[model samples]
Target: MTTAAMRVPVTRGYRFEWVKLVSQWRIRLVVLACWVAPALFVAGVSQQATLPVDTLFGRWMHATAWAGPLVLLGFAGQWALPLLTSLVAGDVFAAEDRLGTWRHLLVAVRSPRRIFVAKALASLTVILLMVTGLFVSSTAGGLLAVGDRPLVGLDGHLLATGDAAGRVALAWLCALAPTLALAGIGLLGSVALGRSPMGLLLPAVFALAIELAQMLPLPVAVRLALPGYNWNGLFTSPMQLRSVLISVVAGLIWALTATALAYLIFVRRDFTNLNHDGSARRAVLAGALPLIALGAATVVVLAVAGLGAGSGIGQDKVQRSLATAFAHLYRVQTGQLNRPDVTEAQLGASAACTRGGGQTDPEGPGNDWRCVVSWRLPDTTAVGSAIYQLDITPDGRFVADGDGPKEVNGYFLVRTPAGDAPNPLWQFDGTVELLPKG
Candidate 1:
């Protein structure tokens, strides 16, 4: 056979792989589930009497159309994302092994490299579609549940409908990196293990393990470097470029490494040694395979840790975040009270914050920070000042609780004209900036 005839274009194999993939009823079902399940979850959450305040935006399901996707993003990172990626990418190569069709595929393509490329591209395309389906369905569900009101963002800014939609969409787009990272691990399993079930199982286990590791009392740099944690940065107000970059860089490195290893293994396999019945395949570096995966994950974490180390946490940033959030939420509080014409500008909110009797520098995460908040009400010369206790985290999130019992800040319900409503000042969520100074 001519050399030209032996080397087929990857595009042909790509199309063939895609058709083979979509032809499966299971693939179609997975896509449908991605679209249907999130909407159902949002609908259910909306109807529940109690809100899920533990999640970032879960308490606001009835307040805005952006919360559903944000909630789903949090939920998925725990387990759904790994499972979602593995369902397809994990099985892409292993399915052929289980069906005893490797020999047939090799005969058709004659180039394992091209075949691997085709399958990888096909699986990734499907996974991308699945992610998109989730994004769209979640957003649709939020709209149905909440009727598209302005979103009070993490920073306490009131985001208009279009603006909230834009940020939520961008956040969803940013999720693609972690999805790809987990997918890489799945693909590695599919290629190395040659069992559809193992391929599917490994990535889910990887995700759970990552989540468990995050719970340890590890240093902030190490926690930030963990594979899926960077999703938090994507939703931060004004965007944390360093965190986003870490997510992308870590994901790309891990993905490319795993894919490259898989490609190398796939291309070098001696297909001519298949049994007569095409089922007696010896193990493919069984022990070394897992070691390789573990080593790759470890290396990526270390490299990414250095990147997160420079993202300084200090006093000024936290103060700015808390003060701004206080201003924004103060307006919300007044509006809830049926106070007329009370605007953020008119409120003139400001705060003076300190750490641990001025003994500790106002830097880093702590539970002992205090802030004295003061804001002017419309048509009032008196300045109302109240102390706020702050609990700050390395990720730039802060929960500021109102100090005085009479002051209505912290996670509490307040009386409004519409009836009992959430107090914007109570246990309010806000963010400090994490970008490294230029």
Candidate 2:
């Protein structure tokens, strides 16, 4: 055979397989799901009332972070992406066996290796296209719904607008690492099953099993073996580039190993009895073992770290400090000291303080008293001390305080008891009111 004629058959095989895989509707659906799911999730979060304006983008970003990578993983992970990838990959070899066309194609093309390469390339192309589509669609949807606002970080600090966008993009890219490893697994399953279903179903089942195993208590070394945990480097803010690099290296190793295993099995296995019943069961067990062990170890390490960290100091502290600051401000402005004998209603309405001596009025019946109030509320805990001035009116109808002449003046209009006439003496700014002793 001339070298030119030899090249023709190989070139034709590549084109034929490429067209077949690309035209498959299953690959199209996975791509669609990737875009649609994140868009819907972001839209739903936008309509929620309780999510603060500042956090809307941050929360939405997290929801869709896994969408792009997981779409790729679905092909490689064994269930969703694997199933999709397998629609073409699994059937690449199996379809030939099922149709009794394997021997004929091998004879026609005269090279099983070329056919395998073509199919692998097609499957990978589809995976990459779907991943790209997902990233673009989800990022656009999230940005549209939430607006291009700066995101609030986990620590209650705000991330700069450009930095937040960059971090979000990095997160999506990080998620892609696991999917690459999953693709290799899918290829292995494709070769092993000699049928699409086994190749597709086993990878998915393995992914789930790994996820479940990671939930178990285990050591860090074991946990690192699971593909899902390795992708977490993508979500780490401030960009843990070192961790991401490590995950990439690990993922590449998994891909290479799975690909080698698939090649060996395909090159050696007999396709004559492709309908063999036990093959499916064998494939399931083979995929499950390593995945589950790795997952369990990952879960254990995470749980131990979480428990050791202790219960997190929550948002309650922030609220408490703000409340305390307001409480102290109120106490300084009013001379009424908080007393156990005071009614709950009175206590709630009054700012209590201890009386301190000040300028006295000898010409009138009433006395002038100076006072100080010290109280702490949770929000104001950061502010150690606060003080305010108070002045009781001559007839005891009002109390007034100001930092300077009319500069920071305020009054509490005293509400008189029921059936009692209004008293100018008790009247003050918005806060103070005299109730008859009960």
Candidate 3:
């Protein structure tokens, strides 16, 4: 073939790959599973009020039409997203090898690059269909089970049904980036490991492993680099724009890096020696893969430690954050926007926090620090105090858990009011930002 002729657009190759993909019974079955499974889950979950509360949007299933999908999105971030995206992407390249059509397809195409692009595109198309299928099915199940109702947001604010639906829809759209990035990772696995099973299994294993690593005592920055760390940002009260952006950027970096590595491997691979089955069998390099993984892991650990070092908020910063968060929480709890006596300057909400016990180490388990916050309420009848058990992120963000005897049930930060009318001055249930002092 002439150079110009060989350089023809890969539209035909793409069409060919897509056609073959659609014709496969396996593809149809996988797509069916993706669609039906989420629907089934939502149907069962919507009938009950006791859904997993550890996740966002799980507290109230019967309360809203959008709860089911939002809850499922949280579970998806754990494993479902990785598995579903990888299911098709992992099969893209390996399917050709498994069916022993690599050489024929390569020969039929004008260039290997065209064939690669076509396969990647097909895989991405499949991932998109799966996401759409799940989203639609979950939404349908939610609406069918429960008629449209106002949703109680994370900040204890009630959102109208239409507004809640819009936010849920936006969240699903945001999820697209992470899923596509996982598809790219799976494609890398498919290319590296010619066996279909390896392609299917490795990406999921890697995703789960990374999740487990995030849960480890590693630095918070390291966990933030993982895929699902900020997934809950989608369900935040105002929707955490910064967190969403960070997660998307991390996903893009992983996807592009994996794709580039896979492409480099594909270009340099020797395809001359094919097994009797017509699949090109590349020799696996001994120890190289493990060594590379170890090195990468070490680099990540060091980077996390470096970033985490001295990143915690000091006493003054913590006090300011506590005061601000307490004021806001008090407003939400009391259903009063503002109280004249609760002013920061006059009230003097002071928090004495100490690190140790539950917070022995910076990255240890359980909430590390406990703060005794004393403040005068709007009535100013007497000084009131409450205990705040907090877990601080490496970047100085504090999340207070008020699950102790002094507070209400579930996780929240509690403050006892000076008067007996409203027992707790502030009952906040979210992360409190501690900004740097200028």
Candidate 4:
């Protein structure tokens, strides 16, 4: 008797794997966790807005309007994503050994390549679902709690409401790129370290280690290669396209290399000896330690460089400029010069004249004159204080003294004929430059 020809199409393998994966309860649990966690976090933030305290936290929360959603993505990528991917990817080959079904499957399906492709596709689908769920949940929560108001950036600049929302969306999308790299690494780990906790925990640990290393003050070249840099654009006001592009390229390299290595090892290794073997433990640690060390060293070098840079002169200049500019602008906007009171004695013994409000000037064009201004709060609970000085230049221009921390020095263009209807002498116009020490 001749047996009927038996032919199982290659496409059937993927369908079979997907059907098996969807039937598993583990995937459902992970999907639920990804969706629920961010929803609850958003609810908690909304409740916190009603508390009676300083608005510092409130302001910070408003600024980071997209943080909750992004953080949910980060958290899942760190642990949950890896663990879930491993459920299918890790067990792809090993489960056959555990169930003593590998030989049977080998005989029945007659193709290991088809089985591998099917399982990989199934894992990829789950990751896509989780990422989508995180983005939707986060956007909903942020809008509900924060309102669609304009965003105030960390630098104190304002962003229009529409621009802020668009940037936020871009930021979320940028964050996902690194997450995909992480998922690829997890897939590699699951396949290589089959049926062991190392398959699950090692990738998560590696991701955290990379993050810590990037925090160090390393060379710009090395930092560009690390995955952590991929998210830096998210924090920048107008996203730095160059930096983001470099990070994306580096992530792609790492993902491809890792996946290739995992596939090479899994396809060649014998799975029949699957048992509690110390050899597998050694292999896992031996492979992971060097990468961890490299990441750690990068962090240390970068951190030291950052500390050596001191308090950052550019930042200091920006802050002082902003403070001075805002003060003057507010005065201009309000149309009032509310000078505080200073005593004649506080102006120094060389004072030529003293006004009731503590304003003072020295006798000659070359003298250094100092004045102190003080005012009591209406409630009498606190007192406001300031000091101003005048330095007479050889050019006959009365330069307002700003050499000391208490003084703001600048050239004052006084009116030649003193007080008039629109007192020209009383009008002060020129740049108010802060001294280096101040």
Worst 10 residues of 3 by lDDT: 429-438
Global lDDT of each candidate: 0.74, 0.46, 0.62, 0.48
Q: What is the C-alpha lDDT profile of model 1 across 1-438, one tens digit per residue?
A: 885588768999999999998889989998898989888888779778887877777778877778889889888777778887878888888888777798888878878889999999999999888888888998888888778888887767788888888888877777777678788878777876775466667778878987786554444455555566455554445656776666666666667766776777677766676432211232235323644565456656654645345335677777777777888777788778976756667777777788998888777777899988788887789888878898776666677888765646634788887898877777666776665554
Candidate 4 lDDT score at position 372 = 37
Off by over 4 Å in 3: 1-8, 147-163, 234-240, 276-377, 380-429, 432-438
Each candidate: RMSD: 4.4, 19.1, 6.0, 15.2
Scored by Cα lDDT, where does model 2 land?
0.46
By lDDT, the best candidate is 1
Question: How do the residues 178-268 of candidate 4 rate in per-residue lDDT, one tens digit apiece?
Answer: 6556656666666666555666665566667776764454445465556642443333344435556656765665565555555565565
RMSD of 3: 6.0
Clashes of each: 6, 43, 2, 8
Tens-place lDDT per residue, model 2, 1-438, is 864456435567778877876676865676777667756655555556433222212222332332222233222333445445445455566666566677666666656667677767767777777766666765666666656665533221235667666765665565566666677777777777755566665556656766676445433334344565333223223333543454565556666666666665665555456464226554555544544554455446545544212111112322222223234334322323222232222323222332334334212112233222233434334322322343332111113233222211223232233332212112122111111111
Best by TM-score: 1
**lDDT score for residue 260 of model 1:** 74
Clashing pairs in 3: 359-368, 402-412
In candidate 4, position 2 carries an lDDT of 21
Query: lDDT tens string, model 3, 1-438?
Result: 686586537787777787888788878887897788877788788787465654556656755768788878878877887877667787787777777777776666747777788888877777788888888889888887887887755444556788888888888887886676677678777777776476666668767887677555554445446655354444445655664665677666666766765666666656664642212243133212532453366447535545333333455556555655564455444443233424455556677766785345323333567767776766558976767777765433345655334442233232435423222333333443212221
Residue 221's lDDT in candidate 2: 38
Per-prediction TM-score to the true structure, in the order listed: 0.83, 0.57, 0.74, 0.59
